[model samples]
Target: MMRNKIIEMRGIVKSYYLGTPNELEILHGIDLDVYEGEFLSIIGASGSGKSTLMNILGALDRPTKGHYYLDHLPMENVRDDGLSQIRNKKIGFVFQTFNLIPRSTALKNVALPMLYGGVPRSERSRRAAELLQLVEMSGRSHHRPNELSGGQKQRVAIARAMANNPAIILADEPTGALDTHTGRLVMDIFHRLHQEQGKTIILITHNAELAEETERTIRLRDGSIVDNRMNGHYQLEACNESV
Candidate 1:
């Protein structure tokens, strides 16, 4: 039997400042599907719609046209509360900036999401500790954001993102702030999560090399998907021939 799709987007169109003369469409009729355990990367240059598409997929923004289904629930018809529930329960996000509270300890930062979900204090601490260990940050659990290195801070952010055991993890330029070796370490963690934990990961990056590490790569240009390939394989000859 085929694995169910975790995310489905059909003819997704998004525009900023709709109806005004300055209105500009960012995503144009995007059609994409992500399977339950797939690791996918979306790559594009600056001004491409990769970030816009990521925002829509993560439900941080809604499409002006088209449909989005997350775990079989239609998002277009949901109210704000329903959307928020889905976001909290089904999806997690990591950003390049790490986004951890400067004054909070790593454990506290990771525990905040569970607190929002109303988990008990003991259970929250247990889960947060487990996730921190998963990211190899158990020793630094008491460190504040400022006390950690850039890579360590991002690891803490990743641990926080996984605190709720979300089905999908959305990462935007997750390694942008790290040095080359540290960036590879972060990617190794992501790879292990997909391989061992069966998590669905969608990463957005401007680096072509990073995109090649995923199982699938979607290339966007000027707000459109110029190329999308599976198994992280694309032929220069084929692209040249198409052009």
Candidate 2:
């Protein structure tokens, strides 16, 4: 079976200040394609334009030039309102900061996205509970962010990201703040999501070791992709207990 293209970027050029003297180009005519159900990483150092590309991929920003086809929709022409809808419906984001509301319980934080999507009160609560269970955070459903440890907070964040059942999960520096063992636990969850649930995942990270765990990697340097490679699965001893 031929896999569908979830993302296609052609002639992608991102620039700041289009016509002014301070105009700076970040991504230079980059072309790329991401297929459905694939696990891939975008690896780059600081100032490599990875962040700029991430914003474009997430539909938070548009390319200064070129066509961005996300799920076959032309993103360059999408208005802010339309893009907002796409972000809410099509992409799940997991960040290093665990961007949860400090005062909201784990259940409430997981339910927040569905609430924005206008899911009914009962359905939201039910689905949020399910998502927390999937992330193995069911026991902490009533805990606030301040009450959880770093890894626990991240698990809650991942659950919240999965609430809307978005087609793609975009994780940026997901394990950056964790110790080695905790990072392994988080990576294992992502692996299960891709292998078991068939979720398409794009991880943006500077950690080469972490990137190697994914099936493939696109390495960026100085606004260009320097290397794209398929990786052998590197094994790490993950916690046998639930995340």
Candidate 3:
């Protein structure tokens, strides 16, 4: 059986301040494919264009050249409104900073995306509560962002991101702000989402060790893929022996 390709990028070139004295091409003619229900980690050092690729994949930014097909829809020529709609419907982003509204309750924060999608107030609240419960933050639903710990805040953010049931979940340095213990918990949540919920997760991180946890790791260097390994089922002993 042939599985569906959830994301496809061909000859993607993204540049900042184009045609100016300070013009910088961050991504250079990159091509990649991400499939449904696959957990892929994009690993790279600082300033290696991994973030630029992520921004393009999430529809947060446009590529200066080439095409991006997300869930079979080409985003190369999409207007801002169309891009925004595609992002809201097909992609969910989890940022390192959590990006939650400080003044709003966790439930309200999670419900905000659905509200923007015009979901009714009553139904959105119901769905928000369910999502909060899934992230083990139901008890803190009424608490504001300032009242929660970093991990709790991230859990709320995860629930909020899932509110729209997006096809792809783009997590950019999701555990960057957490302690090791909290980071493990967050990764465990993501693991469950990938394994149990069967979500197509794209995790962008600078940490190589973190990439080991995903099903496949694509290492980027100087705006290109240095290595792509599908070592999803590698034994710990085998990895240690190879090391």
Candidate 4:
């Protein structure tokens, strides 16, 4: 069963430089809540602090001032080692860059996270193959990053993201590198993940059009939320199951 809220943020304030006069505050006292199994998108132009907020959400960074909770666990002020464990176990990240190992096969890339989590080699490989199949990449499991097209690499990356069965998937411009058609394909996979698997997906994008595909959209401007509302595209059944 899913929790009432998978993520919650209160009084989030992020800044560069601790106490000096040159400190640049990127996020200003923001409050947000995301329910379990929801598809959410955060949209903003460059310099709007969207990326900074994503970093904090993914446990890559902590707020300069604020409180954040993931699965009801406080995220602020955690030690580096603790943060790393939480990131690996609780969150999955997909980036526009398709950060796959150039020399690793698609199956190996998908299996990497499980490897880090200390799953047995045989079991990791078995689970990796299953995840690759989930993303419709089973036929290309042997291909390396250099051998695949941008979309194919991204599919592999998506499979890799799902390897650990994380509580949330945080995508940073996931479709930004693909062409329009390919981008739609990637988005379709995300939708299937959300609707069929009930994944809690947090997509970060500057494209308003892409953001509209999600159930809820949050627009940020100048370090503050300008809009937070539900889109008509939300499907009630999407949050009902986990595959």
Which regions of candidate 4 fall more than 4 Å away from where they truly are? 1-3, 233-243
> Over the full model, what C-alpha lDDT does candidate 1 score relative to the true structure?
0.90
Q: What is the TM-score of each candidate against the true structure?
A: 0.93, 0.94, 0.94, 0.94
Model 1 compared with the native: what TM-score?
0.93
Model 2 stretches astray by more than 4 angstroms: 233-243
**lDDT of every predicted structure (CA atoms):** 0.90, 0.90, 0.91, 0.92
Report the lDDT of model 2 for residue 128.
95
User: Tens digits of per-residue lDDT for model 2 on 145-233?
Assistant: 99999999999999888888888899999999998899999999999999999999999999999998897799999899889767773
Model 2: residue 124 alpha-carbon error in angstroms: 0.5
Residue pairs in collision within model 3? none
Per-candidate clashes, comma-separated? 0, 0, 0, 0
Clashing pairs in 2: none
- RMSD values, in order shown: 4.1, 5.7, 3.7, 3.5
Over the stretch 1-243, how does candidate 1's per-residue lDDT look in tens digits?
467898999999999895679889999999998989889999999999988899989888889999999988889878888777777888889999999999899999999889988899999999999999999999999989999999999989888889888889999999999999999999999999999999999999999889888988999998889898864243553355467
What is the per-residue lDDT of model 3 for residues 110-189, given as tens digits with 9 covering 90 to 100? 99889888899999999999999999999999999999999999999999889999999999999999999999999999
